[model samples]
Target: MLPNQSFVWTGATPGVRYRFAILADAGNFLPDQCSTRWGSTDFGSRGLPGSPGFSGVPTRNNANGINVSWNDYNASYGVQHWRLYRSASAANRCSDTHIATLPRSTRSFLDSSAAFNTDYYYTFIASDLNGVNGPCSSNSAAGFRPGQAPTVSAISVSPATVVAAGTTVNLGVSATGAIPSNTVAYQWRAAGQVVGGSSPSYSFVGQGNHGTKQYDVLVSHPESAFSVTRSQNITVCRADQIVSNNACVCPGTLQEIGGQCACPPPLVRVDNQCLAPTPTPTATPLPNSFPQIINQPQSQSVQEGQSVTFGVVAAGNPVPNYQWFRDNLNPVGGNDPQYSFVAALSDNGARFKVRVSNSVGSVDSNEVILTVQSAPRPLRPVLECVMANNDGTLTAFFGYENQNIAAVTIPAGTNSGGDANLVNGGSILPGTQQPIDFSPGRVRGAFGVVFSAQGSAAYTLGYRGTGIVTETANSQSTPCAPIEPRLACVNPEGAGFRARFTYSNQNAFNVIIPSGPNNRFSPAPEYRDQPINFLAALGQSDHFEVVSSSGGDLTWILANLSATASGNSTPCSLPPVCNAGGPYRVQQGQNQVTLNASGSFDPEGLPLIYAWSTTCPGASIAGTLSPLATLNLVGNRQTCAVNLA
Candidate 1:
């Protein structure tokens, strides 16, 4: 192909040779001098040959020689790299022959190396590392162009079937057909009810009254048709109460007694219904005293030194005033609900009478005999105690702590007269300790006191002076030991109490003493802080009892005595003490304020006793005094308010 007139192989390869030629015109005309041979001496030197020929390398070199060569087309099965070549015409076409080597990674190449808009033939052949070329591959035509459309796919709804009355359902739509994002929209409907627009899914509450309770969802996209509507049925109904058996009471209406609407007992029918018994008149045996007084037909026998408490029951209009009498005199001072004889003796005759009075009339209780005999004096007497003395007789009838004689199961304190003493234990005051015996006291008149002392002289003492057994003062030679006294004082407001004290006469000379100490008081009894002490000088060997001047004042009582002087022997008047009424007060309609100087007996503070006396009839006793006690009145209004005494 190098303008040579003869066939000559340039490179060495067995069984392989190449020839070059060009078809000037397709199956037709050939140009003049198209078959001219170079280096053949056929056309004389330097003269123009009638045809183009191969030149330079193998045969004689010549100008104006064009040659075209066609190598055996090599078909490469797996080769990715290929080169393309094309020729224009015969001998001089060697100069026009061009080769374009595809990139090593390229599998195809276009013949742009040739002139544009011209029919340039191309062949693709593979090259190997050994420089051995393979046969040319079949030629394929191509031109630059643009790309294709996208795809869309998966579409779904979460909780496809949901219960009615739920808010919203989520539709998860997925697609991969084409332009999925821009193409998708959703439409939803329930039964035949259409929801506007489109989403993956839609939810709606069932219109129970309007239509069938069902829903469906439709998903759509731009690329393709919308998906079929997904549907679900939800059950919905109004809430209703079901009654099965005997006429169930109409919702909240009250049913008749024995008609599936019976109420608890002691409760009477009210308002065409049964309700808790409203506050009503519960007669408390007229006297309003508990542990109902069991009247004895005649006198009862009591051993000496055994205190007996007696109660008498009498009923009348406007409540009765009671006076427990011994020898026609009121025993134990006031004629209140309770009467106590600390210790009995032979002198106590068998006759005791209680007189009751009311607004309408008065009645004399049957003479109850209490015959006293000589016996060992008890350590203490029966003391009926309450935390805050206020009237609770009627109101607390059903309360656990109410004074119900039948329910008074346990005696508070032990009494030698009531039971056998264990280990010769001494008597105890009421409210101080529990009685050891299981047998409850008769409670007809008195509740037994517990015995708590261990010593032989251990004694239960109640200050009630009407006891048959008389109090004997120790001889002057024997020198009775001093006892801390209880005092009562009157305050401008009500009653107060003071604790008794005997001043220490340590200096052996008359010296003025300023009470004892400034004991700070605690309103709440839980935290008992240390008593505040004050300086008060006292003379030695002086016998003076502390006295409270004011009425109804609370004062500290001496718990223990420690005098500076040795064997300080002095006897003073005993401290006077009083018991408080109950804590709650019964009023006509308004709240009440109860004042008590009970337990205000402090000799060093005040001597007089202060007690609250009210116009209310139900006012009972509280065992101690306080700063003030108030009761909020309840129940129906009353014109004639009962006085509390």
Candidate 2:
């Protein structure tokens, strides 16, 4: 039969037994070639009972296995019994085993044979008195019994003990005992505020007031909903301050004399202070004298793209002329004591000095080095959209644009240690769902964090390097564009290897990248069957694969961002499939429509089960448990949407 067409069987008598079968090939339907293996067999003509629905959330308990409950099948169809099938792999439903056969009234089952830390799928089916089984439940319920919770062995900080202010410190935690296949998430917090991302190592710059700061890293995994925290104390002192008597204190010359910062010789203490010795009188100055250099320029360190300046003070007769020199040879500044310019990467480790001269003589200032560190590319956080919930709360969907060719991790925090912070009324809120590890390029609606405030409350997002970006929880924002190429999955294909790549375009219009520097693969023959045109906001691509030799890594370059994949790269984990076709509309007087979700598929070639639900009032759904369902509206002018899972 053609797609969406049904076969009809006519003329059935009461109390008469009937059977039907469908054969794939004509040879299988021939009298001499008939075989049950060719297609279906042993189906009864009498209608089967409605499929039972899973009632409550399935729970897995240690040693006792998984417990599952479901609603009873329709009794009017003359129920016989219920069968529970279990499968270890969602992609292989044909391998499911009949684990239990229960009485007609039974609605619960305990599968004691399940293994811990492993996901299992379960479905229930009913059999009629005629001995024919009804359809299995539309969707399978998954259950996983978690193993041991994660443990933190120790937390370590580099610099070992103390760090100078304006210095970067590295903190890391060693953790173990998480579920075998689950990834552990890390959150580093300082003084109870999250300061790091989901990485085991955290980079913290010691800024602001100097003191002993407390930091903790929380390690967790979703498998068990369990977490453990380990903490470390870091001591920091400012540039002008010294660690004396276990405390940060200013030098005695600046005032405080206790705590090991004693005054030097020739300075006598009087009235809780150190007084400099009296100055001796000197002779009168000559008409022409050598220039005396003072206030020599200090060394400077700054990130790339930042500005730096060097200045020298001098005392001389006839007002000494000044000139600045770079690297002791090249004249780089005008005839002024101050030299200032924007720093570049090439200026790192270069030295600067000033020559003060008059008619009599010239004095050169001490040379100082300028250290220029390469700054990380800035990541711009974009607030894509806001959603108002039925419960009066608001949810803000956020995404980001990473200018780097590689991924960037921005920790969670407020005004420190992170790439961005979300603040409401001066109080920082933890962005639990915000993506800390940002993939390169633009990603729209990556994650959302909720807000409880209502009615036009503006939330501010403070991103490092980018000033405060404010948006109301109810504001509508435009989405950003095109995605970076990524290595989706890799698998061994015969003698060679196959690597799949994918990209996302958040723009409403398609984007095209002509194969060249912007879109090409590395190591020659740049166009490796990759697509040049990308669909707009279509989630992920159906995906394109590249076959390569068994050895080297194959990299896909798109818009200057590159992603490499090899045979050894991690395989992709496909998520469950749910595709409800159409924003289907009907005329004002039309009350019924059919919804189809037959186009949904699993990338790993898994069998899919569909469950339909709707949120319209006074409406009833028929075939609610199947991939194809019908929605009937009870009144005119009613609007609704159906969801498939």
Clashes of each: 112, 0
User: What are the lDDT figures for the candidates, one per model?
Assistant: 0.36, 0.69
- Which 10 consecutive residues of model 2 have the lowest summed lDDT? 423-432
Q: Would you estimate the TM-scores of all the predictions?
A: 0.17, 0.26
Off by over 4 Å in 1: 1-185, 192-198, 205-213, 219-227, 235-645
Which candidate leads the pack in TM-score? Answer: 2
- Candidate 2 global lDDT: 0.69
Q: Give the top-scoring candidate (lDDT).
A: 2
lDDT of 1 by residue, 1-645 (tens): 334345444343332323344323334565534543344322211111121111111111111121222232223222334455554322222134547666445433333233322333344455543344555433323211111123323434444333222324454444344323454666657566786466554444433232224555565543333454455554432111112242112223344444334445766655445567778688765443322233533456777666677776555455557777776675543656556766445546646677666566655667776776544222222222211101111000000121211222223333333422221233322222333322222221122122212112121322112122211111111221222222222212113222233333222112111122212221212222222222222211112322222332233333233322111222234354444544444445445555533433343343343434444445443432332444334445443332222
Candidate 2 lDDT over 314-400, as tens digits, reads: 888888999889999999878888899999989999999899999988888899999998666666666665444334444455666
